[model samples]
Target chain A: MKLYEHEALGSIFKKYKIPVPRYVFSAEMNDAVRQFVDKEPGVVIKSMVLVGKRGKAGAVKVVSDKSQVEKVFSDLATREVYGERSIGALVEEKLDIEKEFYLSVTYSTKDRAPAIIFSEHGGMDVEEIDPKLIHTYIVSDVRSVYPYQIRQFLAGIGFSDKELLRPLSEVIVNVYNAFWGSESRLLEINPLVVARSGDKRKIVAADAVVILDDDASVNPAVVYGARSAQGRPLTQREQDAILIDQGDHRGKAGSYVELDGDIAMMTFGGGGSTVTAETAIEAGLRIANLTDIGGNPPAEKMYRISRIILSKPGLKGVLVCGGTASNTRIDVTLGEGLAKALDDMNAEGKLDKNLVWVVRRSGPEYVKGLKMLHECFVRNGIRGEIYDSQLPITEAPIRLKELLIKLVGYKPEEVV
Target chain B: MKGTVYLNDKTGIVVIGATGREASQVIKESETLYPGIIKAGITPGKGGSSELPVPVFDTLKEAVSDPKVGKLLNTALIYVPPVSVLDAVMECLDNGIKVLYIITEHVPIRDSEVIYQEKVRRGAIIVGGTSLGCFVPSVGRIGAIGGKDPTVAFRDGGIVVISKSGGLTVTTAEMFKRRGWGTYMALAIGGDIISNTTYADVLQEIKGDPRVKGVVMLGEPGGSYEEQVAGLIMSGGFDKPVAAFISGRFQERMPEGVAFGHAGAIVERGMGKATDKIARLEAAGKKYPVKVAFYYHDLVKTIESLGVPRDFEDSTTEHVKPLYSTF
Candidate 1:
């Protein structure tokens, strides 16, 4: 789940015509913030970070005087909330709150459906509020969340006034539509404030937290363009990996996270790689990085990944493992790709002679691939052990550790 | 009996998007293993031309309407892109295709939901949206699951290897193969967010098969599929001596909501943690004689202890020899 920050969510709400206060998002007290505050004397300043509970963290403040806006924004900008520095501060026109309601649409794993949770009491913690006051409805389908159902749900939660229910139901329907349309996992509007401006009253979302489903193919434009899952920015290595993945159309290749460890590891398949990583960690091995190579990528792609994994500093050993081969040829991944990469590194005198390598693979041409990899290791004078499909997938990491102990006299740490 | 299991030897097959690279390669390889099984190929606007013995038709309806191809199209192997998978699946379901192997990845979740709902309504079985497809050793192979060589990881046996990860399917099968055991069938159910078929669903069908004396399941964290399988076992629906391996234990230590590998392999709000799956499956195993393998090697050992058949050793050598020549 990738969460859109306050400014992004506010923009989305505005685009959908859901009521929200006019806001300016900026890193500093720029022209936009100046103009936004000039129009409204009273403004609410919020640190634009993905983490919640900003009010409790002192990341949000209500500034009644225009002179206090810059100081509040600057103070919030310098402080890190929940370990994430504020990307910017959302300066918005403060509303005259008459009442507050809470509305959220999210998928319920237990019900296996989209659920809408609404409460009359909104701005504060919904969890602490009386459970009886909260109304929950699990929509069988997003398309089938009818106005009658919404009205009934609202009425049950003490929203009985016809005029109030009329606009509330419309907001409910639109919120549901937006949730479903965006394929969002969670769309929460806390403090769905009923504001009074002179004689007119309107319901507006004061704060929004929208987490789009990572599986959904959301429009890049709507998502504020190529957002990172880390909620900040991509590292140089991650960016390079993404570029390599984009460079090829042939098998799937990407996902590289650098860690502080000596052993560089790459595993194949989704579940298999995680299991391998866990097993390595269990055996007192700290992983330098994690790379998933599957879909039978060509030799060149494998070569690139192997190069990247090897390039990481403090690499004592390299473990390349995966589950049984389905369509991806084991020979291509190891023999033609990784083995070649290792050979090239060896020729350049970049590879340490004592650096242990463990290759465990299954699938097509297991014997031949293992043979090629074995020969390459011998030729490069790189100490390594190779296992075929016969060995269980999880055993490779332990075996690598044992080999590291025997060959390099490396002592296993008691980290469990 | 809940849904059709179209992996048997008698079931005929068709290759949708047959002219595509992956489809054509798998078709050619499958012919060597299970000859005469692939009856028809469908590629829009590429009809009249033949992909060797299998005839190419413009649409599924065109192929199903032909007298020679009508009766031999029970299974449809879809090789269309992710965007077109839902339509391709609907076409197969409409044409009375009992089983669909959706061999595409990155299919939108909304589209997967529609495909899943339609499959249930029609009492049909779907293998995957990102699946490597299924391989029934000696019967036939669908998709490119077994690689260019099927014999490396597969052989005729009593164990049924069902996995969310396609790569693990081969690994589990090979584990049995090395132990002088063979699988009754290996189903790569695909590690997608919305799998058309779940482990429990497959377990229900495999439980009835007399040939399948035991089962090997390879599961990953994310979703409740493993929990559901545990439920089925606890409820006495699955009677076989099951050896299960659930991966992604390391994900629990990582930050929540970061996808480890597959899109489906994610731990959210601590719901689908690997430790939880292991505990649930282990608790259920205590009541129903289930064996949970924390490591892949443990799974291999558990299967080895379950006395089935040791006739695979001779066949393994013979089958593996032919594979060397293919390269």
Candidate 2:
């Protein structure tokens, strides 16, 4: 993930060959004060927290008098911004403004590619903008982007003014290049301030967010800062799970949450789990969580992975899936680790009744593992039924749908 | 004896990288192949190691070195990746290894090219660069360890399969698996291409094998491996009935300069389009029928209607147990 400081964000406009007011960053307020004391009114002093909504959070300020700079700086410097542990704040010179807009390039988890978005009305909660009004374009291949396509997108967004159109178009193309070039996940410029529409329209980002790419193994210098923008970007428990993965380097581990559903899942491989999760979402069941037990994780490590996932209080059930049977070894028995997890949850009455486990595995030692799972379920008296491979992996979502049918008091063959 | 014919009674096969899941699925796949031998897994560090019931050794040399080891046995499958594949292969060669099957993907094209040159020098028969490995019905199997239950898809039949995508192999196999369609043998020579073994190599093997009457080839964009195989077919290299499928057509509608899926697909530019491959197949022969399937079910139907000879008396009754049960 990329962490672009306010100053770096200002430089992005310069890189795109667009115009922007001067931006400077310093560890101490005195250096900032010394640099800005000579400047008259129209200087903006903003607390630079990595989190968003600095305006709502009262971290942004407009200062004209030199004497008031210290109070404004002190108020934001010492105070916690956005209720997050305060990191630091930034200060910038105010733009001679006329209009505000929003533009961004983000990787769509759904499409599994980079998408560019633009909004004529910016400087507000982007979420509030009608998706229909927002223009989006998906780049299927990394190599296919062109400057003309970006220009077309700007025209489609209804930018009639030539002066505004040219710079906005340039910014769009640059951001797309920057995203693909740097492997950034998100590049957002809110309040894409436009200084009037006709002759000398200046387009500048009053605020910006650059989330570096996570999929590709690009060096951080090519993207943004090494550390992520500060916030509880993940739940405390999710953070703990990441810690476990890092702590146990022997196993392949990672956790991610798709915003669409409530059914938390953990499986293996880079692709199969995604396909399975997509199937589940397509099947209309909520995905509570997403995790992967990559590679041939030892039995103990498998237990640790399972424990971390089960520890999440909001999870409903998990779909323990693996790569195609031929490609890799999938756990057949649910294994000792998972069985132990079940036992612990049972002991503490933590195994939720709505819990439905679907497993599809092949490879060596499958029978023994399956035998162990049957015995575990019998011993635990859990309301569980196992479909031990009388079906294919694709049959999993279909079978899970059946189990859900039983739980919701609907007929087993309910179309849903 | 061709298309993974077993000369012995042993049902189990040894995988060089047995610690992997692919090896496991291959073990489970024996039901389709008509089970006989027990699988033995061998890794480098864990000699005398056992992941399941199968025994694992530190090295192939150690595994085969023992005097107590009986018979030349069935083929040995290798799942070791590209970086370490050369050593795994050399060890197999040094130990008097025969009937070698490799399932590893992305063995640097240069490395494979070298291996091919070495094989020609040594006169050793090696199969694969990107292979799903191979399956021998009613005897033993190697590579792509577990997939649903191979038994459901593969049975004693006339249809023989050689595919380049591992997932497509399973999907193709699943067509028969779901409908109880059986096959004499199914080999997934995965990835976009293989350096040593091409479709022609397997076609000759299948044509010679009395059990196989038809051959199915699965192709993706990038390499001309499939086209080379087609050229051999056009020149009357083998008389076996052939059916093929070439995917990645959806890639055309997508803007140029965009990646479709696998890294190998980057070459789907200019003349390398999916249509070109299909045209090449048609030009090869009127009998060489090629189907297009973006989805597995569609591919399954295409295989079902190929009009290949059937071996199983009853097409629907056999329900192969899953390789492993989740319950």
Candidate 3:
């Protein structure tokens, strides 16, 4: 099962009956730091972004006095540690602890049933601990988790007394309830801290990681701050693309991606793009973008996607490669678009001698398109190379690599 | 001499509804790669004018009669809707263009089966009843509506890709791109159970190819094909390392065997459990050892682990070159 980071999963646990320490999320580190210093001098300042092992990543910090709070918050929030967008830090009150415990409930892929795992010893890497100490019970039915079932499972983990067992069992039951309700792939509570005897102690979850099954479509708001399984906030572009793909809005075929590379590669088939990218990479060339030219679409739609790929500032080249399998033809739009771009570049005097334009067009209408492309380049005197071959995809990269090395002086031997 | 060839004496790609925009795309892509592309001379009453540059006659015979026309690429990429795919694929196959790559989708499965059997008799390569069609990178791509993107998609790498799902093949490619481990070739033959070609065919192709150093197979729950392929590897012929990750583990948690997306995703007693496939492969590894390879065991270490004996481990970066090095 995949693991979810603190803010996303911890938020879920604090919603269900699981006892977790009080916490607050804020966009401003200054405000969060001020609140922590004023309310509790000793508190944990954690980066609220989605990432694992923040404690090790130095995203997590602990401050004892009021003065250190600002320094810790700024340090944790300023740097971009993982790929997640900076959302500031989560400040929370430190739970008073005497001892720690471990517990988890998850659906077993092998057994085809829900399983509960519990341990008296917790916190320090639950996975590294003895698998035997983490007592496990597979339950096919949810209703089977009665008071006695919880006792049986807890007793297996060395809890014999009813007094300590009663409240712990209730916590275990509610946890499973929340887990099942959330349809979580995994619910891990590392070091469910148990309070000391005779002082009114409570078991609080020290850490939580919950991987929710997206297919369940259980609203994230219901569970509180649970991000999608991808473990990152949905970029507007990505969300928009998903929406368009699922609906009939676009009606045209296209795939898009925003990357650091300059060249925007929008090819016909999935197979062709893979080969082209691999070839470019192997040749010590970089692909600034990747996209699919999708099946039959109106010319307008095709132009729109081509424009998007070309819109990238660094995009210096475009590769239009497709396979020839029986029927189908490479459209003139592929040629027309490249020609249009070249005309723009020439008019703007932006066309570089080193700029590479390669097109491997196949299928029925290929002859006309290839001829059209050749005429356009020749008439314009724009530099490029085109190959009409019956070779497998593996050979295309070699050709591209050879052209790049010969024309651009790129080292062909270096592995990308 | 043993290199894979996209076109052969028996392979001649045909375009149905040759005048339509969809058919035009098929004609353009196919003919550009394969020079001797013979379009199916069919356009109902308007057979007088050539569809694009290709000769068009009133009947399939007139199309095949061209001296340049070799064996018919029987499988037609029907640009027409569901109503026309049945007649189109049937006519092409009946006239002996056995290998049909139907680009059109949503055609009733029953109609697909009828054409499927007829093509089987003729020994035609009927790729899609409902398919994204297929692509062979630089060599040639068939039924690919998207012109050039696929040329770059199936770039040169060592992973032999076999997928039951069509779009999932795209996801697999993305993974390869992310890991910087390109692929030798990936065949997404579509999810039709009576698929035109089986994983066995693709695996056999990979086994015979010297360039494929490793095989990365993507299998979902259902069908005994995974078992069949696993058994084929057990015969010790597949010298390349096989690395795979089986999805549909979530499906096993369901009540019983239920068909998922692919026709082959059925969980019978001996079929379609991700763990079971893993177990079978593990067991096969014990007996045959060299034939079965797993992908999860570190991408770097996979070559050494996949039955390529220790003495022969090519430690140099020379063997580590991209799969398309020879290309």
Candidate 4:
């Protein structure tokens, strides 16, 4: 649910009346960029990405000459920042920096309240900043935080200049307003600069890092459009997987993220799925995708996700794993739901016979569930292993690897 | 709030979204565990209809005002949609329902914040946004935790099990069952960033409860709940020995902000790391009988190392047999 810089500045920040330097973002240089360049005295070209510290990644550049604008935009847009391809390039008016400060609005788990974090020293990443220097103000009210309140805190934190205090406090309030108005889980403005606007000094948000609440009642996807958690475009399988739980709270069978490995995983429960995926990776089983399925989803709910999991191309292995369930009926989720999916795929000749499969699940009616799944494996001649809770949850990966090594000549860098 | 979560003669229950599939299913399963606790159901405009085996009321107010239902009901289980949670919670608070167990996940953070403010202002006990349920063996259960018959995994002994995830809560209990032990209480506090009911809150409420001897906590890699629990154990309220398991340790190697399974399980700004949280627990362990386990499966052995006394009982109930008859 993270928003790109352009997305935030164009809509949310402006809606909150936070001063943002005029900017234009595009995949390629266009007339808008040329007009924007003609108006601003100085321009900063930044790579539009979800990850922070784009400056450190050499994705940001200063265009001193107008002739270099298109080349810089192309360079920033084409480059990958921290392993993710740049979505586009953002061109903004570079401010004449008088000073910089740090500000953000996010939830503080310790206080169970919305916290506005402020620091006089900016431009440094949050981790590098001295924890003591950062002042935290817990706001019980999510509706608003008044400017005078921030003004008092700013003066207490050594803001002696009365002229700068009011405007800066208003800016801070606007930032909080943006965060609260947009229902953002996190909105950080690093290096919020006190810039010289002709003869007057103005406060402006130099950079924005926004991660919207995905679970918000407002459906962030409607505003931000649909996206994968990894800041990439959604694959067809991922799109289908997300639609499984839309407006349906029966049980969550959705939460799917595509990875670059060869194993298609149908893991259940949040904690169970994470533990299984970590073990699978440690055991050197490349995961093609990851999913967290649980909460006693109906048989049909499981049927759809199961089909999506098995429909992925180039998957050499399939791992169905989870901890012992509390209430999720294995007979429904697996015995009936997944069994039917496998039958359908097999009938359509979409099922891959050469792929190795391993399942380690236990819970209510798991015996019937595993028995039904085993019949599918038998009928399709799929080679793999199936285990219940007798096998250690962490050991499911090693068991899959063992079967893979024996049956498919899978090799691990280290001796097992 | 001492026995509010536990089902007893004084406990009165109402299902907010009783007509919903999940809510009705929980009502059915919970009735088998303990009937009469769930006195009524509330789904607007469904009044005078008997769908979930309980009398349906149009609103929480109407249900709370009934002579047969209102006088006894003190707790509510909410299963409404994410957007309607704020209103549902407010109604519960206004109606004097002391205990609320919310089974809905994906509740907006702002809504959770408002709920927290009001819950504090009113001094009401609230649990979960994505919580599985609360359980007290031989007493009753709330939400869909511990399955239809929790006795299959849970038996009243002397232990208290607290976990961030419902699956891990049951897994911990089942593991203890293998070694012939059970829990006095096992509940999921939910893994949302803003947890209305946290480990510390539960520990505070359960302070000096005689049925609880020790506690085994299953933690994840996000939120400061585990750290707060460590602080509470170090303080005077939690005198009993505790064992903790913080899962997702490998997240230390991944990118900082990558989302783990839980919404609150992401590591941001070098905070909420499993190693850091474990370090805090280990620090508290020096002053308290806190045992830390790194791996998920290592929790049982870690808790057993505490050497606390257990009220040994024949945990072998008839429930476990039929469920595992396939084996």
**Candidate whose DockQ is highest:** 4
lDDT of 4 by residue, B49-133 (tens): 8777789999888988888778888888999988888899999999999888888888898889899988888988888888888
Give TM-scores of the second chain, every candidate.
0.92, 0.79, 0.71, 0.92
Error of 4 at B155 (Å): 1.1
Q: What DockQ does every candidate get?
A: 0.38, 0.09, 0.04, 0.47
Q: Which ten residues in a row have the lowest lDDT in candidate 2 chain A?
A: A221-230
Best-to-worst order by TM-score is: 4, 1, 3, 2
Model 3 stretches with alpha carbons more than 4 Å out: A1-18, A29-37, A80-86, A98-192, A195-198, A208-264, A267-283, A290-305, A311-317, A321-353, A360-389, B1-161, B164-327
> Ten-residue segment with the worst summed lDDT in candidate 3 chain A?
A242-251
> Mind giving the per-residue lDDT tens digits that candidate 1 earns over A1-416?
45545544555676666778877778787887888888996999888877778999989899997778788889886678877778778888889999999999876544445678888888887767787888888776544767788888777767755678878888887787777777776788888989998898888888888876655765432446545554556567766676665634467666676667889887898767877888898888878887778877788888888888888767788888887776677778888888898899988978777678777777777778877877777777777667666456677788779777877777765765
List native contact recovery per candidate, as a fraction of 1.
Answer: 0.47, 0.13, 0.00, 0.54
Sorted on DockQ, best first, the list reads: 4, 1, 2, 3
Preferred candidate (lDDT higher): 3 or 4: 4
lDDT of each residue in A206-279, candidate 2, tens digit only: 77676542323433433443332224245654555555544343434545332334455765543344445545
Q: B1-327 in candidate 1: lDDT tens per residue?
A: 311275776678899988887688788887877788888899999998865558899989999999987887898999886668888998999888988888887677767766766776688888887788887775777778878777777778778888888877877777678777887788888877778778888888767777777888888888788888888888889877888888887767665455667777767645767778889888997778687876776776776665545645633342221111101
> Model 2, B1-327: lDDT tens per residue?
234532235323567777765555555554354444544567777777545456667776666655444243335677775566766777777676665666665464334544655566566767775566666555435554334455544565667667665544554554555454566667766443224666777776556667766666776665566677667777777776666766655345433433323324433225356667777876775655444443323445565566664455434435434343334
Interface RMSD, per-candidate values to 1 decimal: 5.8, 10.8, 13.2, 4.5
DockQ of 3: 0.04
Candidate 2 CAPRI level: incorrect
What's the true lDDT of residue A395 in model 2?
A: 56
Candidate 4 chain B has its poorest 10 consecutive residues by lDDT at B318-327
